[model samples]
Target: MMMTPADLDAFAIGFMLTERLADSTRDVLSVEPFEAEAGWIVRVTLADRCRGRIHDRVRHRTSDTGCGLCGIASLEQLRRPVAHIPPRPRSGARALFSAIAALRDHQPLNGATGAVHAAAACAPDGTIVAAYEDVGRHNALDKLIGATAACGVPGFILVTSRISFEMADKALVASTPMLVGISAPTTLAVDHARAHGLTLVALARADAMLVLNDPWNCFDAVAGEGLEPPTPGL
Candidate 1:
């Protein structure tokens, strides 16, 4: 299916559920688009039976740029508690940097507009498996989650935007162990990452990177004393 920014909020959730268009979960009943005073609204109707519950209307209220949490009604809807991340093997700093460097080349939309955010899932060896882009960082994250949900999580996620609480929340939802950002994280994002045990790395330039939370040893590598000494060449 073709995905535009307008349909992401509705489509992304459906895409992640392992439900296809032939299945009830992703079956599209109808779609209605209308203009509101704020901007534009797209109401999507999925099939009656969807992933255990019947879904009626899922709304995507967006500006021209496709920002996030636009229609949130209460604070309760904003914060969601997630399970702590489990312990896992760490990736070397070199691998992390390699993933970050490779991420730039995958973002054609960002190169053209210079305004969109891109999210990528990279392996421990620094190969990028999937990448998605959107005007909003949250949207990019959601699309990345939907696209890579079945990949059994990756070594880390490389994002081209500042870390936020919602970003951390989404990572936990997707069972991602670590998140690396090109910008710094917010105070709430740090707290959320710590609470959920999701590693948060930010301020990531080519030369340096910061690790906010590393409960799983996903960022730093400890030097061992058992290194072999170099031999002089004759």
Candidate 2:
């Protein structure tokens, strides 16, 4: 089933704080949905230790399709310091294609709705460890993070949507070493990936992919198969 805004927001707030706030430091009390001028708002109430308070509310405004980092009140909230990610072994083009094929095979939600985005965790060898789908790309990632929080699945993340700054931030928060996208990434996303030592790949297809940043060089294409190299200067 497609995720409701309330469910999406709950996962987002819950997991977003999972790294920043220790489980003993905070707890999500409730998630309520409300109508807003911009879109539907998911109000998350939490018990916070930082403020020594019983109630701290964070509002998440989500569009019908679910955009990340929306309805923020300040620029400071838009940027977060990503943790340094250790390098992982290079994933060959064959492995990437296999993982994408697995993700597509398992995405029943996308097959049914054609409206959801997916986030998957793939092992170093390219096997899909786990996957989640949601109306919003961020929600998909959040759900995947929350689902795998305790499982300690160490692998790269693959998304069926464009790589946005928020997507990069979320993966970094999850301590993911690499992120692959079916579409291109924003400049801010690339910058964050570079600064945080996270490998970012995009425009990945069955035939080829682009390596936006690979500080540890954890990506490899088939020696003579799949996508041809881009011609000079587009």
Candidate 3:
């Protein structure tokens, strides 16, 4: 995978969880990074129960910065079943917009380079609890998941990229109830999100957002304001 090498530890942990290699941090024994001839390499040691799964589950591949499913061996691997998210309380549209407004402030790397993507874990009120950035959008989300896993999943996840099926899948694996993307979502992403009970929002701005999926009516507007009407049966 191509990514910025800043947060190797978080990236390692997040990749493990999002890829379903490790259930949680408890299954990880250690994360170590070292300089290599080509670049930096992060070595993650998994607990005994998690060790065997790695050999059968993942196939190393050369992935570009944009594609998320570059290494999948077959169509079946791409469509691997994911568990549905647990039911959670409803969320307000206000919180989503709040996070959209605050997302820029948390992206130091993007501010400097104007070339990185960011993923943030937001509180119920849209406060950014933690954020991570990388050249690859998937890597950024993975880092965010790794950084926040110990503290428990946040109320939502915010990304500065389009919502692909892989993005939705990662959010679901992390058990975040909502995912807000600054750009649009692919058709498959919307379908997967709706099927798995994830609240998917895209084209987020300070004033309004497009709600693609709200399985439990979680993104209700207060006083009939804040969000664009969702498509029927999404």
By lDDT, the better pick of 1 and 3 is 3
Candidate 3 lDDT by residue in tens digits, 1-234: 678999889999999998888988999899999999999888899989888878767666877776588877776776766765745734577777788888889998899999999999988888888999999999999999998888855578889999998999999888887888989999989998888888888987776678788778765544486356554333
Residue pairs with backbone overlap in model 3: none
TM-score of each: 0.71, 0.75, 0.91
Name the lDDT value of residue 44 in candidate 2.
Answer: 63
Deviation of model 2 at 90, angstroms: 4.8
Best by TM-score: 3
Q: What is the per-residue lDDT of model 1 for residues 162-208, given as tens digits with 9 covering 90 to 100?
A: 88776777777767767888887888889988887777778876656
Question: How does candidate 1 fare on TM-score?
Answer: 0.71
Ten-residue segment with the worst summed lDDT in candidate 1? 225-234
RMSD of 2: 5.0
Error of 3 at 51 (Å): 2.5
Question: Could you give candidate 2's per-residue lDDT for residues 65-152 as a string of tens digits?
Answer: 4445555556676555455564564566676778977888868888987988888988877899888887778777777876666553
Residue ranges of candidate 2 with Cα displaced over 4 Å: 1-14, 18-67, 220-234
Better by lDDT, candidate 3 or 2: 3
Root-mean-square deviation (CA) per prediction: 7.8, 5.0, 2.5
User: 151, model 1: CA deviation in Å?
Assistant: 2.1
